[model samples]
Target chain A: MAILDVRDLNKSFGGLQAVKDVGFRVTAGSIKALIGPNGAGKTTLFNLISGVLSPDSGTILFGEMPVQGMKPHQIAEKGIARTFQHIRLFPKMTAIENIMIGRHTHSRAGFISGMLSLPGTWKEESRIRNRSREIMEFLGISSLAESESTSLAYGQQRIVELGRALACEPKLLLLDEPAAGLNMKETAEMADLITKVRDLGITVLLVEHDMSLVMNISDEVIVLSYGEKIADDVPLAIQKNAEVIRVYLGEADA
Target chain B: MTRNRHLQVFLLIAVIIATQLATMLTDTQHYLTQLTMSGYYALVIIGLCLLIGYAGQISLGHAGFFAIGGYTSAFLTTYDLSPVRDKAFIVLLSRMGLLVSTEDLYGGQVLHLHPWAAFLIAIICTIIIAYAVGGPVLKLKGHYLAMATLGFGTIVYKVVLGTEGLGAADGISDVPGFTLLPGSEVSGKLSQRITNYYIAWGLVIFGMVLLLNLVHSRVGRALRSIHGAEDAANAMGINTGRYKLNMFVISAVFAAIGGVFLTHYNGGIGPSEASIMKSVRYVAIVAVGGMANLWGALVMGSVLNFLSLRGYFGSYDDAVFGVILIIIMLFTPEGLLRRDLFSDIREVFGTGKDRGERA
Candidate 1:
């Protein structure tokens, strides 16, 4: 069964239709990649699914529940977490601290308990800290734990963001252009990481422009162009789809 | 990290204890009273630090909450309207040993509510008012939030100045001092300068401990996340709007508590207490201390307030504060303590390279 389902989603900013009649589905525990040219509204669709922007008219379902119209935090609480296309780590915080914030939903300690330094609050806090460190270790960035997030290298920052989203313990993860700016080696590592994430039983839905990375790691690829889905198929079929090829080549020609 | 926090906690306790001993050894009532006033300011400033430092929400009208607290206690303890005097609630309170009968200047019998009861009532009222105001006001970002708080402060100041029953521009006077134990033969008014000093500083210590613990907790991380990036914080399953409003209300409560105790200590509250200038002065203190640094705010708030009370700036208090604010913003916008100004000086002297390598 699909973990995420978007049906006939529509969104516009002013008169420019950013996402129009967009729809897709990601089966539970599968790796899905969304690939499109610059103006394809892939990020817009990601935003819609993550509840950053509401659709003008559509339904978003995470499992059996409708997620459209829910706030971003509400959607996150419903077991969906996302990383930004642009890195958005808390600049002044340590990398580990940034990831621990992702554990916010799972932790139950609140203002009063925190202020009093209750035993339970401390226990939960230590648990979160330990878990966050474990995540950093898994990402192979444990050495960067104490470093300021903004001071890290671009690839390291991307890994930190991924670690942060993973700390949410989401059933479904959305990665928005996770390898937008990286060398070939970094992109290869990111692809390996995405595969590792999917192997952990979390459904992965990612939007990327790098066709090589998408075709290599994605079990299914959804292609979008000019705010509409142009092709939805396996990576091999998407590579041969005439319309998807035309959109990419047309952008290259122009 | 745990060891560092423990050390900090130890240092904080030591500082509070040393301050207490110093006041006792000096035995100067006037200086003790001045320090006590600084303590009140410290309570409000510490709350402002949490609001500005962690939540990154600016409030320029905290003095309005302070005024509300002062006037609430002042009016309740001093004024005896005919309706309120005869109310069943008042009679019940008197029966319960919470209110006492006292003779007014006109030889009329008036029911005087216990100062402790009045203080609690003032805190409750301030919280309610803060909730109502913070809900909408906290939504505004940047200068808009500042402007809204400033307008709220001005409105409160105008209302206090125009209300006849509240003593108009002269403000309410003769607010009663609180007794620790009511309806007891040993209970006496907490009117001594030394007693007031300890009470004020003791509250400050409590506030500091609470704030320090909060900053190290889960909620504190959420607040810092919000400050770092509200959109990202919301995306991380944090209710950003709710947290912002909560901080705003909490900061207001702190200010109100300060106002209540200070009013009782001074025996009066004036319209100037609610002035916009006073609110700006608080924001200035927070900025001067360092935004997002709790201990820095406490130290700077108390020290600056103490200096001001000593008449060092005299009539130029506002002007001096403004200049300090401008200088801080221009030179070290991060905050005084947060910026390593000494390192920058060393760099200017061309010795920073060697020092940096050694470190």
Candidate 2:
């Protein structure tokens, strides 16, 4: 079953149509890659799915329920979480604290209980702390838990950002340019991590500039050019498609 | 952290007692009046610190909330109901024991709300105003947020200065004392000066404890996340807007409570209390305290307010605050008391041990 379905999605930025007539579906627990060159509306699509921008006209169904035009936090509560194309960690906080923020949806202790220092609030706090640690350990960054997030290395900061998203216990995880600034080794490890995340029952959706990373692990691939999708198929077919070669690979070669 | 926080509070309690004892031993009991007033102003400072530091929002209208509380209670308690005492609503309120009967200087019968009823009404009114103002004002960011709140403070100042029934520029005076117990009333009477000092500082300590607890909890973590990155926090399922709005209201309530008690303590409140300069002074204190440090805000709030209230800055009070605000903004927008600055200072003094420890 598709966990998310975007139907006839359309978005315009004044005179510029950023995304047009786009439709796609991601099956449960599968890794889907959204690949396109710059200005192909990949980030725009991610924003629409994450509710950063409402569609001009479209229906976004998550888990078969309409979620278009809802607030970002509301979409997240419905079990969709996404990281940024650029790193956006809470610079002043520790890595573990950054992850525990993801558990905000899971923890319900409010300002009153927190101020009163109620027993339930304490219990929930400890649980969130321990769970955040577990997520860091899962990402192999347990040793960096106490360091401030921004002070960490660039690759590790990316991992920390992914850990923050994972802490939300998302059903559908969106990764935008997860390997953009990484070296080859870090990119490979990120691909491994993405696979690990999918194996843990998450449905992974990603927009990546690195073709090798996309072709290495994606179960299915979707290609876009100038705000319109050009292909949707398995990795081998996407690599061999003539239309993709003309608009994507041909541009890359030049 | 828990033990350290309690230790800080205990230290504050010791300081409160020591200051009172020192004042009495030196025959300088008059200082208690300024100290008491300083405690109330510090209440407003710490609340502003929470909004500016944690919630990542700026509000210049807190003085408006303060004036709302002061003026509401002052108006309700001073407005005589004798002319309409026979009305069903007045009689009902009288029967409900919400009305107080006293005598003016001419010995005529006067009827009005008891201080307790007026105080409750004042707080409720502050909450209502805060929610209404905060909902729209918090949606703005950066300098726009500052401008909106400044406008709010100015409007309150104008309304209070021009309203005929609110005593205009003369403000409300001869307000009745708030009798919390048999002898412990919130008033400026010299006999009760020491009691009022403890009352005011005790409330400050209570507020500090509550705020400390809040900043260390899940809600506190969420607030920092919003401050650090609002859009990222929202994508992670944190309701940034609701948190910002609620924080605005909470801080406004703190300011209002300070206004209510301080008005009763001083036996009146003036339009100047709601002035934009007062609001700017508060923001200046919060900036000096370090944007996100509650403890720093408390200490700075207390010392600065005391100095100003005691006339240390003389006629240049607002100018002094304005200069401090400009300097902080120009050189240390992150605030003056951050941990890194302390570490740097220690290094300069050759007392550093944890150099490069943040790494």
Candidate 3:
């Protein structure tokens, strides 16, 4: 069975169909790209799958288990973590603190024990802190650890967001515009990090505006237009789909 | 090399204690006695710090919980009102079925409690009531929550005013003096007030330590996270609703604990015990001190209380209070205490500190 299966998924806001009857399968350990022009419902679909928005009508199965009504955090607990398109790091907190919040799910001790400096809870705190630091080092933002989020450059913030999502230790990592504001060097680093994240025995699902990054790294690509799936195949094959070319151009024109 | 934060804290505490002891040795001074009262006020402000500073919740009904605790203990132990109000209520449900005699409620005299017992009982009852009210009250956000709790404070004040048995507008008097231990039996009316002053300050110290430990723990971090972003906190697996409720209970318990001391010190209970003005004063104390900072609350509470006693602002004390809040709102919105005095000290010591750095 596929790791992620969305069957007949649909969502609407008032009279507008934000996402319509979209179906796709993400096999385990694959870099699957959901690529579309802006407002092609790419994020809306991610939101639905990640439990941010309840599907008006659909079935989402994560490893054969239907996950429709789960809360966003619950979905995260079930091994799915996604970064936001607009970069929603807890802006006031230090970057490391932001990552530590993501590591909250892993902390075992209750508040009272942790605060009282109880014996057992201290170990868990250090462990979470170390893990967060490790993720920061992995993302090459270790130097930015003590910096406030808003102070950091745009690329660094994106990396911190990735580090936060990684702190969740999810089986499937969803990247929403991870390369959005990154320069070419930073974009390459992001691509390399995505490859490394996937190599760490995790499935990767990404939505990106950078066609080069999408066309280059994605093993498979799913195309959506006007909330409907127009194509689903290997990236090379998707690159030639006529409907996708037309939709892409049509969106660019509008 | 990390600036010895604890050393600074210990030094501050040592200095305050030394000052307190020196004042006590100087004994006959009226201002010193009032300083002790200021300490008690600071204790109550700690709870306000937790609520407004840590939880980012606005409470105008904390005085209600304070009064509930104060009157409960005072009236129950001193006046024998415990039988009708507390004990009778318990018995009516469990032991005696639904039928309760109104006569059984009446002769429960109003003022005769061992101050310590009253304090403990008041705190417990206040916590329970606060928890009960907080569960529903916290579900409402922003100003709505404030108004709901403000209404509760008003209700409590009105109850205290209307109930003639509870001293009415005149308030209770001759609240027996303090006994540090169970039966040490300290005497003389003046000495009793003095003893009460010390005990109240001691409780304040205890409350401060407890609150300090509380806000540094996991729950404190959760509260801080919620304050930063409610949606983000929930998405991090925190039940925001539950945390807010817990904060409400904690804040109320603090106020109630402070009330216990306040009641014993004043040797009285009245409608003003739960007045909105009292709660507003606390809110101001927390605000001026810096929300979320315990020391801020402590220092600000003591300072404000001391100034009021001196009639520093004379007839315009309330106005000065209002003006202080406005200035704080306009100039230093994060609060005076929230600005990190430790960092300031570091800078003063010629150490280059990382200001505006968040990581």
Candidate 4:
């Protein structure tokens, strides 16, 4: 069954329709790559799906519920977690603290319980810490656990950001341009990390400009141009699809 | 989390007690007097510390709450009805279990109480008013928020100035002293002065401890996240509005507590107490201390208050405060305890090298 289903999702900024009739689906435990050139509305789609902005039209179903009008955070509670295009970790916080914040949605402790440091507060806190550490270790960034997020190198910050999203223990994870600034080695690590994330039985929907990473890991690839979905198929088919080349690669060559 | 906090508290209490004992033995009455005011100002400054340092929100109207607490206490205390007429409310509330007589409202049998009760009442009042005011004002960012809060301070000053019962333009006097505690024999000017010193210090410590715990808690983390990026914080499932509102209330509570002590410290209040200039003093204190560090806030609070009290630069103390704030903004930008400086110092001290190394 599809974990996330988007149908004719529409969003417009003034005169620019950032996302137009964009629809896609991800089967549970599969990696789906949404690829397009710059301003192809990939990031905008992420925002709508993540509920940062309400879509102008159409529907976003996470599991069985229509999640179109929910707040970004409410959507997060409903099991959709995301990372940003630019790394947006809480800069001054320690890495473990950053990941702990991601667990906030899952935390049953109310503000008073956390504030009062009640018995259950510490128990939940330790659980959060252990889980955060496990996610950090899983992403191979365990050693950076105590460091401040901003003090880390760019690649390491990216990994920690992933760990932060994973700490939420979401059913579906949306990654926006995770390979944006990585070098070849870092990108390879990112690919391995993405594979590891999928291995955890979580649905993955990602936006990337890196064709190598997209083709290597994505179970299905959807191509977009000017907010319109032009192609949807396996990575091999998307690689050969004429319109995918004509729009995305054509813009690249230009 | 609970490990060393109590030790920190004990050490703080020990330090305050030592200062009092030192003053008593050496009879450094002048220093004690100054520390009294310093203590109150420090409490208020620490309040700003939480607002500016952790929540990353700016306020230029803290003195408004300070004045509100002071004037409320002064007005209610000094207007003592004679026992015959004062017998009016006492009979009514006593039967109702409220047990409030006119005497209780206006000094009653307690020592610093008239002022103390007013201080408590004013703090509660200020929280309500601050919530009302801050809810909308906090939405505006940067200089706009500053300007809005400055206007609020000015408006408060004007209201205090216009209300003749609250000392009108001249200011209230004979504002009575603070009760050392509930129903204590700590009366008389000298005793009240000593009591005020300790009480002020106690409140300052309270503000610091409360803010420090807040900064380390999940709320603090959420506030920091919002400060870093509001949109991202929302994406992370934090209720930015609720967090900001909570911070506004917490900051107000701290300011109100400080104001309560301040009312007793001055034993009188005026429109000048809540003036825009006074609010500016608080922002300056926060900036000098360090925007993000609680200890920096406390240290800055003491240093700034001490310098002002000493009249260090020939009555240019306020000007000196303004200059220091400007210099920090222009040069340090990170205040006396810059976040970067801590890291650099930690590196030199050899404690933070490993923390930053693996990253």
Candidate 5:
């Protein structure tokens, strides 16, 4: 099944074309990597899909539902969760509480009931706590549950961010440069984590600079340069394609 | 966390009771008047605390909401409708028991809307105004947000000062007391002093319980996340705009409630109540109380409002508040009553920490 289908998406800032007529598709439960050189509209495209930035004109179908112009929260409710290229954790909150926030889509205690401390809210809150803990355990960071988010190491923070997104139990997960600040060992662990996330039957679309990580875990890869798609194929084919090589390594004659 | 919270609430109840008893024993029951007034101001502070502290939004127009509540009830209850009493609609309102006939200063029977009706109208008006204003104002960030709310306060201040029917510069006077029950009415009567004190603090207690419940629940977490990082919260499925606006309205309603009760208790209100300085005082109190700490906001709100009401600062009242704001912001942006400070104080007194959760 085509879980996400995009067609002719366009975005611009003033006279600069940030993204132009880019389109792609991801099969359900497959791992896909969006690879590009810097300034190639990777983050902009990710933002468009997550509804942080609506495209100038485009159609994004998440399981046949049009989500192009929706707000981020609305998109989130539609089961599309994302992490930032830069880590954005609630600095004051504990690790467990950060993950618990991801369960916001599932929890429904409104203002009146929340203020009144209604009987039903107690049951729901404990459920959120346990489920958030379960996600942390799965991410293998359960021991850091009570530690404040700002106190965590770089790689740990990324994992906690992933746990937070996973706690939403979304059908598709968007990871933006997940392995950006990771060391070689942490990068290997992150690759393992991505595959594990894929094994859970959730579609994964990630933007990354690490070629080895992208080639290792991704079932399919899409390459872009200067706001346009240059190639879309399996990882081995992407590596062998002359057009993708020119974009990454630059023109040899020049 | 649960046990600590319950203990504090019980301690608050005990303190409220003990203070009343102490005043009675010392033959200084008149102090309860200022205390009662402080309790009302505390209502506004606690609400603003939630909005500014938890929601990470600043509102300098809270005093405008307070004035709206005060002026609306005052205008409704004191404006004589005797000249048009015989009209069909007026007669119908009289028949429906929404109108009251009270003796004016000259001993003439003046007809007006009942205080209960006026209070309901005031709250409804606050809600409408808050929703309308907050929808656009909360879209701004930082200094822009602060300036917008300050402008709102100035507009309200000017409206009340210029409008003749709302008593103009002199403000509305002779507002009838609100009767919550047959025997218990909100008034400045000496005999009912103790009851009024409890009445005012009881409302504060209720507000505290409600806010505490809110801050510990799912909505509270979402608000904290919004404060820490709005985009992240939105992507986590928390509706930031709706939450901010709802909180703005909720806090505005609180300010309005304080205005209503205090106007009834004091027997009149003035244009000064709606001034930008009053709003700044509230923001300063919240800052000094520590922005995100509910318990701190409440405690500091009561003590400071009590001192200000009792006229300790006198001519330098506004200046004192301004200085307090600057000092708090500069010296301890984390606020004065941090956990570390409490621990340090405990150590100085040689008292062991009450409870330490494992890190």
Candidate 6:
């Protein structure tokens, strides 16, 4: 079953066609990698799917419902949660508070009830707090729960972002350059975490530039170039594809 | 976290008790009156603190809401009526257990509403107007938002100054005091000073408790997240726009409540109450108190407003606020009593290093 299906998607910025007729499908509980060279419109594609930017023309079906023009929060409520290429944690808040904000959709306390501190509000708050702690522990950053997000190390901040996304309990997780600035050991741990996320029955759609991490963990790979889909296949086949070699690796070497 | 929260609540209760005790010991009517006025200002400052400090939104038109509230109550309570209509209304009010009698003035009749009724009506009107205005105004960011709200305040001030029915430049006068206990023959003017003092402080405490509860809840976390990163908050399934609007409306309501109480307590509503300087003073108080710290806003609001009431700044109150704001912005932008500053002060005193380390 496809958790996400995009068809004939297009986006433009004035004279620049940032994304053109791009399309893909991610099977439920599968790890899918979106790989391309710089300026291949990979991030633009992510933005379209996450509802940050609307496509000029396309259809995006998260399940059976079309989510083309939905707001970001609405899409998130529909079980689609995303992390940014640059970490966007709330800087002054503790790691636990950042993660708890991810549980917003799952809770229903509003202004009046929250002000009164009703019994139901307290119950929901305790539940969210416990869940936030569990997510931090799962990401191996439980000790950083009380630390401000900006005060954390780069790798730890990335982990905190992941924990925040996971606290949403998303059916589909969008990880944009999750291992962008990590060292070798941190990249390995991130790869392990991504696999664990898939094993937990959540579909993962990743945009990454790290070839080793992509080829090792991806059940399937989709490649793009010049805002167009170039290749879509298993990782082994993508490495052997002639067009991918000429346009991606050939250009890199030259 | 829970322990710190408990300590905060205990400290707040202690402060309330101490203020009441001090009022009794001093037995100075003038001082008590000044403190009561400070309580009114504190209400406005707390709301501004929540909007600017927690939600990261700014409003320079809170005095517009304040004016609206004051004028609403003033108009309802002090409107003159014909003798026949007044007599009929008096009979109706008496049947409803609201009025004991009606007073005659200058060959005409004056029918005053129950003070509580005027207060409720003012609040409801302010809420509606705020809801209508906040949707469009809250969308602008930063300084643009401030400019837009300033425009709103200026428009309201001009309207109140030009309208004769609202008393034009003279404003409405002789507003009635709140009757403490309902359904009694006694008038609201018998123990007006002490009654108004406690009522003002009581409302201030209630506002403080509500604000503290809000900031400690899940919704408060969402607001803090919006303050830190709006896009991130939106991505996390929090509706950033809705939260901002909600905060704006809530803050406006707080200002309105303060305006109503102050108008009744002062026995008049004036154009000066709607001045832009009044709103700026509120923002200054919140900034001096420390934007995100509730206690800081409360303490700074009360102390500074009380000082002004005591004629310390004389006629240069606005100038004093302007200088204080600039200094705080340049040197201690985090606020006068920021958490880190407290720790640093302790360090200088050569004690509580363990507490500093914990922070």
Model 3 deviation from the true structure expressed as Cα RMSD, one decimal place: 5.6
lDDT digits (tens) for residues B131-202 of candidate 6:
888899888998899999999999999999999999999999877765657532112253566666678878
Second chain alone, TM-score for each candidate: 0.89, 0.95, 0.79, 0.83, 0.94, 0.88
lDDT of 5 by residue, B1-359 (tens): 87887888899999999999999999988899999999999999999999999999999999999999999999898888999998999999999999988887789989999999999999999999999999999999988999999999999999999998888999988778888888888999887798899999999998998999999999998999999999999999999999999999999999999999999999999999999999999999998898999889988999999999899999999999999998777555656766776654464367434323210
Model 2 C-alpha lDDT per residue in residues B1-359, reported as the tens digit of each score: 89999999999999999999999999999999999999999899998899998888998888999999999999999999999999999999999999999999999999999999999999899888988988888889999999999999999999999999999999999988999999899999989999999999999999999999999999999999999899999999988988998888889989998999999999999999999999999999999999899988899999999999999999999999999999777556667787778655566468545533522
Q: Flag the better candidate by DockQ, 1 or 5.
A: 1
Pairs that collide in candidate 6 are none
Once fitted onto the true fold, the runs of candidate 6 whose alpha carbons sit more than 4 angstroms away are A251-254, B2-7, B83-101, B183-190, B342-359
- Best-to-worst order by DockQ is 1, 6, 2, 5, 4, 3
lDDT of the structure predicted as candidate 6: 0.87
lDDT of 3 by residue, A5-115 (tens): 999999999998989899999988889999887788999998888877899998999997899868887887787888888887775678988888788777766645744
Indicate the docking level reached by candidate 3.
acceptable
* TM-score, second chain, candidate 2: 0.95
| lDDT of each residue in B1-359, candidate 1, tens digit only | 66887787678668866876886688654677778889998999999999998899999999999999989988888876445766887778877877766777799877677777788999999889999999998889999999999999999999999999999999998776666544321111434766666678778878887888899999999999999888888889999999988888888999999998888888889999999888988988898888888888888998999999999999999898899888666555667877676775566466445443321
Q: Please, what is the TM-score per model?
A: 0.94, 0.97, 0.85, 0.88, 0.96, 0.93
Question: Which residue pairs clash within candidate 4?
Answer: B53-B291, B103-B108, B112-B178, B112-B179
Pairs in clash, predicted candidate 5: none
DockQ of 2: 0.87
DockQ, in order, for the candidates? 0.88, 0.87, 0.46, 0.53, 0.86, 0.87
lDDT of 2: 0.93
Worst 10 residues of 6 chain A by lDDT: A245-254
Quote the positional error of residue B168 for candidate 3 in Å.
Answer: 4.2
Stretches off by above 4 angstroms in model 5 are: A249-254, B342-359
Residue B121 of model 5 has an lDDT of 98
